[model samples]
Each structure stands twice: as structure tokens, then as C-alpha cells.
Target chain A: MFKELNHLDELSRRKFIQYSAKAMLGVGLASTSNNLWGSQIIGKPTAKSVIYIYLSGGMSHIDTFDPKPGWEQQGPVQTINTNVAGIRVSEYLPSLAKRMDKMAIIRSMTSTQGAHEQGTYFMHTSYEQRGTIKHPGLGAWLNTMSGKTNSTLPGNIRIGGSNNAPGGAGFFDSKYEPLHLGDPNNGLPYIKRHQSISEIEMQERLAIAQMMDLSFHQKYPSKKVQAYSDVYDEATRLMRSEDLQAFDLNKEPQSVRARYGDTKFGKGCLLARRLVEHGVRFVEVTHGGWDTHNDNHELVSNLSNPLDQSVSALLDDLHLRGLLEETLVVIGTEFGRSPKINVNSGRDHHPKVFSCVLAGGGIKGGQVYGASDESGHSVAESPVTVPDFNATIAYSLGLPTDKVVYSPSGRPFQVAHKGQALTGLF
Target chain B: MPLSTPQLRSFVFGLALLAGPLASPAEEMAMEEMQMDAMMDSMQMDAMHGMDETSIELFDAAKAVLNSYCYECHGATKQKGDYRLDQKSTIYSPGESEELPVVPGKPDESALFKRITLDIEHDDVMPPPKKARLKEAEIKAIKDWIAAGAIWTDEDVRSGLPTTYVEIGDEATNALIDKINETRAKAEYNAWGDNSVRVDLSVTDKDKLKEAIIGLKDFGTRLAWIDCSYLELSESFYKNISQYQNLERLHLDNSNVSNEDLKALSDLPKLNYLNLYSTKINDDGIAALAACKSLNKVFLGSTKVTKAGVEKLQAANPELTIIYK
Candidate 1:
């Protein structure tokens, strides 16, 4: 069953990139597809799904993953040993510490962009931010590569919210954009019709709109206009399909929900798990407020506690369900915090060296791929660039990083912008 | 002025020190590394503002080397293995093997570097022994050209560079540029043509962070600048940076930069720009920024920076700026 589905996905992926290229350039999709025959899927896929947990604002690397316990740069936060020998995390992350054996920590994540917007853009798209065009995020790229696993539901979803979240399907069709859920408890909204509008009435209204759109679509032939109809059709399909239940978090047992936690971020992670289980290809759960300029200890403590719980529960749940091997869970941020705590007891953004935790999805856990110096300042060994990190994500999913796909204006762009996958992680 | 042969030898020796400051004395440059240094020396010529008489001689010498050993099989006439040595395009293009022959800005990653510099008895050595071999100087010239972003044209590489490129165009921008040059830090602009800038102090040695900040005071009326990412904190650095008024973007990511430093920024009328990303800024600092009316686009990604302070700041300056995470 999996092989058949994967074969189908491969066929669609070929068509999608071609269709996207042709649609963007107003060229022939078939010819473009022929040219791109050898462009994608260069490796065997290790992951069927991805759960990207973005810790918005920079998390303190010195305080969290690459902690320097007795160093002068060490903050008020203490360190604790994890289940994995020699691995440690912030004292606040008690839950994550216990589950460290299940994770592979990359402590030497580096980037050129330090500001939030640019760094976030770089992190998600594997390209620098430019006013000229919006590059597709990893989720959008994944959706383009593997196609949708669930026909009725969106392949990509963004839970909770952060300013300038890199969730947009930049330059791609709007259908690829993440289905943003501002509140997890709220679930997928506007799925049901109004009480006054009967099913027949809705169908009649859709029929009329479709008839009107058909003539206009033929006359105008605009991709945007076509996307409008596609969105409406998908929405209509979703409203009637039973798969829409995946977005409804209330469907989970109360104990399971509690296990993930009652907080918005916790619920978001839980919802992400359900969506992935239901065949959503990509889900990004964002937890904000890691800036920690002032009151760093108090603020990080609050965020880390929930993060520790939600992420641990998600990993544990995935493992128990035998889904961990197929699911790639990534905990990332724009960058990391400064090693030096400020006068107000806060750390600043440090991109020189940071940390990210990757779990399951063919990753060898209980191992650290890279390290920082004694002061946790620069990358000590195995420096991983932002593109390298994103390339690893692509690698796990068997997405081709070297494949060059032309944008709307005929500019060739790679999946991870020249970043080689950290094959050592697998 | 281009260095003469004697000066070049001394300069090459100097570079060996520059490349391995942390490396031990006994571990000197390998033969391949020495070849790379010669190539790098030639590449640095591209960054020169003008072509001096000696530089012309150097290029001519390199062209001569190419003519003597490489021109017969790979030149414009025969183009053996579809690898043409005459034109820049053929040299840069991948050969029949479908791998890049030369990777710009990195000779170490280039295939040409491996083949040409390989041992004489190696199977992949160029010139095939049937032809004349590449001399030591010729090999260095080729390596240098590839390393220096592989410039093919005679035009000075830095000639058409815009004002926003890393070296900066005018005296006003030079302050930050000169200082960054002093330390091992990297200064970058948003794009090849864009004026918005990002200067990273993280690459520099830890001891130079203070000096790097002191140099940024020369950014003058520039709108955006990123300094102090992962730098060890000093109170003096903050005092120097707060003096600028035309500041649009400031990135003090992950340093010991504090609320007091933020308070200094509040006085700059045009200084609503603050990137306290993962820093020590708190509710008081966010509240304190109320004095500067243009405070918009505060990224409180990690709540530790804002904690419970953003709401009060928002209420006070509803019209100031409202973009939040």
C-alpha cells in the first residue's frame, strides 16, 4: 500500500513542479517537465511527514542545548543530565532532558542573517530575503514534492502564530499556502455551511459560480482566477469529507490532550500530530516569546516548560504509535541567545552558534552531531549552515536539494540554496 | 601597488600566519595549501581598485602559463574532452563528466584544483606527460584565479561594485568598514545593490568585539546595521552605538546587551529600530521605548525578552508601530 502511494506521489510530484514552472512562466508544462525529468528525488526517502516546531524569537543556546554550566557566560539557569549519556539541557526542560536519547542535537547551527524577519526567511526558504520575490517555505516545497496524502485536507498547516512566520507558499500557487490556524482549540473554521443554507442551496450556489467561472477562466486564463476555483472546490470537498476531522483537536481523548498539555502551543503540537497521522504532509507549530531581552530566566522558564512537555509528549506518542520512524520532528528557531546574560538578566540573539533538536525519521538518536566551544560561542566542530540544516530536512524526505527549478521570471533556484545534507545525522 | 616577487614571497609567508593563527607552529602549510596560497594571492588582485603595471605583468605571466602547457589540447583549436581552455565560459562550464570544473570563491571545492595539483605519477595529472607540465607558478596562478571568485575579464573586479557592497563606497560608510576590516568580523549588505546592511561581529575574535562596536559609530546616517551578535558584552560598546540617530535597524542578537543599552537607544528620535532578539530586554525596556514614538516591529519571539511587558508598550504607542510575533 505504501509503495503504491509513494509511486503515485512520485508521478504527481513530477507533474506538480512542471505544472508550477509552466504556470509561473506561461510556458508548456509537458516540455518543462521533460527538461526536469532528472531534477528531483535523488535519494530514498526516510521520512513520510515533518513536524516543524519553530521557537519564535531566538532561544538561548547557551542556556538550553549547548549549556556552559560553570562558564562565566552561563546565566542563572542551571543544567540537568538527559537520558542520553553526556547530553544535557536547561534545567527548565526536565521533560526534554528525560527524552534526550530520542533526539539528535545539532549545536552548531549558523546563519548570516541575524534579524528576526531575515533569519526566519533564511531558515524556512533556504534563501536570503529579497523584496523581489517570496521563496517557498519548506512546507510548500514538501507539498510540491510529495503531493498531498490527504485529498480533502491541506498538505501544509501552520498552528498558533508568530510575526513573519515563513509559512507562505511564495511564488507558488495560493493553494500551497499553509492553512493557518491561529488557535488550535478553535480547530479548522468555516468548514460547515450556515443553518439557513441547505445542502441543495449550497450546491446550486456552487454550480452557478462554477458556470460563471468556467467562461471567465476560458476567456482570461489567469492562474490566480483558476486558483480561486480550486480553493473553492477544495473547501467544498473538505466540508463533506470525513478526513476534515483531523483538524478537530476535541476528537482526541481528554487524557491525551492533557498529555500534550492544555496550553495553546501544547494543543498546537497535539493538533499537528493528529494532522500528520491523518496524512498532512507538513505542520509547523510556532511558540513565541523567546526574545528574553529582560527577565530572561522567568520568560525562558515559562516557554521551555510547555515546550518540554508538548515536544516530549509528541515524541513519546509518535514512538508508541510506531509512527516515529516515519515522522521527522524538528525543533528550531531563527537563531540562539547570547552566551552573556545582560544586566536585566536576559540574553540576545546569537547566530554564530545555536542548537536544534531532531528526532525519529531515520535519525540516530542519543547522539550530538556538532558542538560549541567551552564558552558556547563559536561552532567547535561540524558547523551546520542554515541551508545545511534545511537540506537535512529535504534529505530526510528525499527531496532533491541540487535540483534547479526556474521561478516565474526564469530564475533558477535550488531547494536548499547550495546546502549539502548532513548525511552524518542519518 | 602589486607586490614584486620578493614582496610576494614575504606576503605569502604572512598569509600562512593569517590562515592558521590557532594552528600550531610545527604544522606548516602543506604543498597543496602552499599552491592554494599562491592562487589566493593572485585572486586578491581582483579586489584591487586599479591595474598597476605589475598586476598586468602577473596576468600576462598566467596567460603565458596557460598558453605553454594547456593551449594545445584544451585551447580554442582542439577543445579536447569538450574542455576549452581559451574561453572563460568553457573553463567555468562543467565538462563531459558533468561536474563543475571550477567553483567560484572556492578553489578547494573545485575539481580543477585537484587534477592540476595532483602528484606527477597520479593517473589524473594534467598534460599527460606526453605534453609539457604546468610549472609551480602557473599552477598557483590558476588556483588564485579560481579562488578569487574565478574572474575571467580584464576589468577590475571591484570597479563596478555598488556603494552597498561589503567594502562600502563612500567615506561615511568607511568608518564601519575600516573597523570591521581591523577585526576579523564580516560586514554584509542586504543585496549586491541594496543599501540596508548587516555587520556580523561573531566571526571576529572575542577580544575584538568592543573595538568592532566602537568602529560602527561611523555608520553615520545609515538606516540599518547589525552588530553585536554573540559578542561578549561591554558597557562602553552600548554607549558608543546609541549616539546614532538615522538608525533604522539594529541587531544586538544574543549578547549581554541589556535594558540599559536599550534605554540609550530610546533617545534617538528615528531609533524605533531595535532587534533585541534573544537578549535581555524586558517589560521595562519595552515600556521604556515609549519615549521613542516610532517603535514598531518588535519581535518578541522568545517571551523572555518581552515577558509580560509588550501589552503595556502597545497600549501606550498604538500609532507608533504594531507589528509583533
Candidate 2:
């Protein structure tokens, strides 16, 4: 049942590495399956779902979670004391400040990749961009490990038009891929019958497709070839399901809608909360426009409003629904902006250090982990790499970060490559 | 910045790869764990025997290891060659092959033991070549159990519950677990690597949900979380559930539960979380929760509980997260 542990045999470690890649990756994988081991979950599940709020472009560490009030790097945005004693945030994020007790902020996040595409890709996949191979994102890894709690819904639903640098499903099967939703306001497009095709007609089309896929499957019996059939079955089940209303935002009351605000990111956060309650494993809501290369203060402060309002509302909403205990809410970004204001009165890209915040899912909130220097120039203590941060998130969900999952071409990869999870966070 | 020698540059690049306090990634790498999986698997089996006590833990651990290897073909799913190891009664007897799979206190006489200790190349190896062969630690753990009287516990490997704490395998808790599983209410281990079970009675049909909660009484000390969300809970349900002395989290959200139901929960001194969202409970319920000094977080969203009540609760205990709309 566990592929990670079944390689023990007469083959020595050095000899196995020297052996052909296919000999190692595909030799004995088919001998085990979910039916064999997954039914009996030895450990009780924790962090059943993840709502990753990705702030696209670069978020400024000095202007948000980590405020450097006395330094010149601290711009016009004043630092305000949070509800938690000694913790402070940007004045623009007053709402988030009042709810800081529920957050554990990490101030010393560093990454190697600096460019937008590479930085975003590294943050999402925990691997540096390589032209030879695309890496699977965290959502794909979670889907592969623990199939979603709700079988009728898709395992992962990504709600923004963010960059595809996360590399959809990597070398995994298509069934493990995410269902990308373009506009949050649209509420799961093309899900319902078009009002033209009847139910009988839909069934007829599916039967015909299956008949054709049978011959195709016979011709190519590889795992990926058979994954096509799984996708068709999943889509058919989703369309016929009574639980698809989990994606419908119209069900929310006007008061609740207003509380999350009318913005797209706000709408996305609300949609994420709704999907998680219905048992979707992972939901990524991307809020763009943080690329404030020019009017740093004005744009960042403006962006912080929707972020603060929507996230605060999300935390409160999840807690009220009793989902926060098992659902992890993460605020992540590609990297942080420069501590030194640029010639355009804006902060340039700073990949040296940044900040990220996580709450609930067994994390001890009302505390800060790691730290940046006084001027936010470098990681001063508990320097967490990009992989370490991602591994920590995976750890909260009880996933084995070190377990090797071989790519189709025989390259071994992990949820976070060689990353050590910060076990202290829990 | 200093690239003096070719070897020095390569060493610096390698140093950068080792991040955080991970001074030596090579030493801690899973390359050392290629054969350790078999060892760890057997260790986890022993882990279910509970606590720091080693000898008795190894006894249960050995049985658990046997279950891990043999149960897939012989337990609950398929009976390959008419042999089964799932039952405590079946392991000691002979199978369709007319050979004794196990014999009490005699490893040499047992066919199962002989097959596992056979050479890997031999077809008689217990797992065959399809599955990985048992490592030395796993074989020794089993061998030691047979050297002693191989006493099988009636409770081991029976509902797929990991008995992390020894006391959790008591008769009352065992019966409660079976009842919860049979009811389809989703009883599960409270945390990974722990023995305590949390029951979620949040099924459709309010009557069924109520019956499931009230059906089991005296759930012993290991019951951790009880989810009674989205139901018309009766007074009897609350009274019956409050007897779980070690209850930690309770989910009674979006139900028709009243302030009086709050009074019933006072007996649960270890209760940490209470979800009363959308319920009609008022200030009295908040006061009742406040009185349970071990409370960590309480949800009062859309409930009739006034702001004054929440204020009183928070003012009394600053650590509690008083969640409200």
C-alpha cells in the first residue's frame, strides 16, 4: 500500500542508484494500491483541507506582517499594535491587526528564485524552475496522497487566473490535476447541462465515449492512458451530484457577502470557505495586483483592504463553522518587496527575505516564528527556505514530506524536495 | 565570493544547499531509510500496544506486524488459498494447505515462521517475490513473540483502531468503538499515532443522529471529539454524551440545541471546544461554557447569546477565542 517503503531487497543503495531509472521507478509499483492500505488510516487525520491564499506579485514584508517602524524602509504606512500583545502590523491592515491572536506570523522566509515566474513557481512547487521538467504543485501532491474527503467534488479547485508555473499535475495522472475556475463570480462554469442536452442525451454521449476509450485503452495500457477514463467518470459524477452547490456563491446571505466585500479576491475567499466545508481537499485563491513597482504606498495600502477584510472574515467564518480546527488557512506569496524604496518611490523585488502567516489546523497562534533583520534586509534568525516553509505546511496536514514519488520518466520527487518541516510550529 | 580552488567552489555550493539548522543533510537523508521502512512498519505495529512499557508493547506489535503483512490477502477482502490471519481463532489452526501456519511457543514448528525465515530466492518465502521480504527486525519481533506464548488479544487489529494508549483497549471502549462503526457515524482516531477515537454523529436524518449519540453510554476515557452538528438534538442526547469525562471538542453547530443543553455539558470537565453556531442558546449557555474552566474556544455566531454574555466569558478568560458574527 505504501510505495515509499517497499524497495528493500538484495539491491544495495549504491547499486540501486546506478541501476537504470525505469528499473527503480516502475519495477514493483503495481503490486500495491489504495484498496490494500488506504482503508485503514493508522493515524487520525489532521488538517483535512487547506485554503492557500496566494498574494501574487511580491508582498512587502516591511509594509505588512513584519513592520519596521523606526527604519527609513518603513514608509508612510504606520505600524499598529495587534490584539496580541507586542505583535504589530501595517496601519492599512487594521482589521487583520485586530484578529492577530489567530495568526502565527513567520518573518524570516527566504527564497533563491527572484524573477516573478520563477519565484511564483518555486513558492508553489518547492522546486527551482528547470526547463527539462515541470514540478507538481502542493494541491496535486495532497490529492495524490489523500483522495478528497468528498468524492463528488473535485479534489482541488484553483480560483484565479494566476500563472501556470505551478506546473499542473507534473508527471502525475490527469485525474490528480486541479479544476481551474476562471472567475469567482461565475461560480463553476460549464458545470450544469446547457439546457439543450437532455439527461438521456448526456448518458448516450458518455456510453459512446467509453466504447471508443476501450479500444484506445487496449492500444495503450499505460497508467496515463487509463487516467483519461477516470477523468470522464469524475466529470460525469460531478455534474450529476447534488452537492455542486458548494461552489455557488448565491447561497450566501447578503450580510455575509458584504462582510467579505464585493471584490473578486473577497469573493474568491468566500468561495474557498464554501468549498472547504463541502470537503474539497485543497483550494487556492490568488489575488493579483501586488506588483506595486510605482506607487508602493498607495497601491499596497489599497490592496491590503480587500486582503484584510476578506481574510479576517474567512478566519471568523471558518471558526464559527467549527472547520478551523481541521482546516489550515495559509497566506503565501512569491517573495517580498525590497526594503529600500526604489527611484520610483516603489519597492523592487527582494527575494532575500519575506513574511508569511498561518492559522488554525493545530498551529499555536498568537506567536511569531523566525525574524528578519532590523531593516528587513536579511534573515536574522530561524532562516526558513522556500522548501522548508512548504514542507511545514505539508507537515501540518500530516503528510510525509520525505516520501519519494517518482515522476513518469523515473525521476524521484517529494512533496517538498529535501525540505525539513518546522515541527515546532505545531 | 571567493572562488579559489575548484574543490572549494563545489564545497561552497553544497553548503548553500543545506539550509536552516540542517548542517548535515547527507547523514539524515532517506538513503539510510531504504531498508528502515520494514523496521519502522513493525515498530508502528508495536506502537499500537501503547505507552512506554516495552515488552507487552512488543507482543501487540508482533501481532500488528503479522496483520500488516498477512491481512491484505487473508482479512476482510480476499481469502487467498483458503487461509485467513484476520481472526485470533484462525491463525493457530491449519489452512486449506493442511499445514499449521502457527504453533504456540514454537517458532521452528510453525510453517508461517519457517516461510518468513526462508531464503529470499526460494519460492517458499512467505510474501513471495511480488511483495518485499521481511527485514531482520520484523522477523525477530515475530520470532520473539512465538518464543513466548504468542497470546493474541481479542481486541488487536479488530476495527482497524490503533490502540496507542493501553487503557483505551478496555472492554467498554472497545464496545463503544464497534457501536460507532456499525452506526456509520464515522468514529476515528482523534489524532494520528494516538489511540483515542472521536465520533462524528453528523449524519442526515436528525432522529438517526440523535439515536447514534444517545445509543452509546459510558464511552470510557478515550473519547475525544463528538460532532453532533446540524441536528435537532434531544435533552437525552446531551445528558448521555456529557458522561464522557475526557471529551475535548464538541460540535453542536446549526442545531436546535437550547441553553438547557449547555447545562448538560457541565459534567464534561475536560471539554475544550464548543460550537454553538446558529443555535438558539442565550447568555445562560455562554455562562455554562464559561463555568467549564478548561474551555479553549467557543462559537456563538448567529446564536441568541448577547454581546454582554461573550464579554463576560472573554473578560474572565483572556485565552479563549470567543468566536461571534
Which candidate gets the maximum lDDT versus the true structure?
2
Estimate every model's Cα lDDT from 0 to 1.
0.69, 0.72
* lDDT digits (tens) for residues B1-325 of candidate 1: 1123343333233323322462233123322332332333333333331223444444456566778887788887887777876765477788787657778767877777777787889987787856667778788987776665665544322122221212224454545554565564545333223344445555454567667666665565553545454466678767666566666556565568777777677657665445555566677667777777766655444435443476777778776543244
Model 1 compared with the native: what TM-score? 0.55
Query: lDDT per residue, candidate 1, A86-107, as tens digits?
Result: 8888898899888888899999
- Model 2 per-residue lDDT tens digits across residues A1-426: 224324433223223332432352322321123211122232334577899999989999899999999897688989989999999888988998988888889999999988999998899898888775678888878777654555468878899965354846765555667888879899888888769879888777667656644644454343433454565677777887656888899999999999999999999999999898766879999988888899899999999999999999999898777788788899999899998998898998998999999988877788899999999999999999999998888887766665555443334567787688777878
Every model: iRMSD: 30.0, 17.4
**What C-alpha lDDT, on a 0 to 100 scale, does residue A315 get in candidate 2?**
91
TM-score of chain A of each: 0.91, 0.91
Worst 10 residues of 1 chain B by lDDT: B158-167
- Residue A226, candidate 2: Cα error in Å is 3.5
- For model 2, residues B7-55, the per-residue Cα lDDT tens digits are 3223323322322244244223322332343443433333233222344
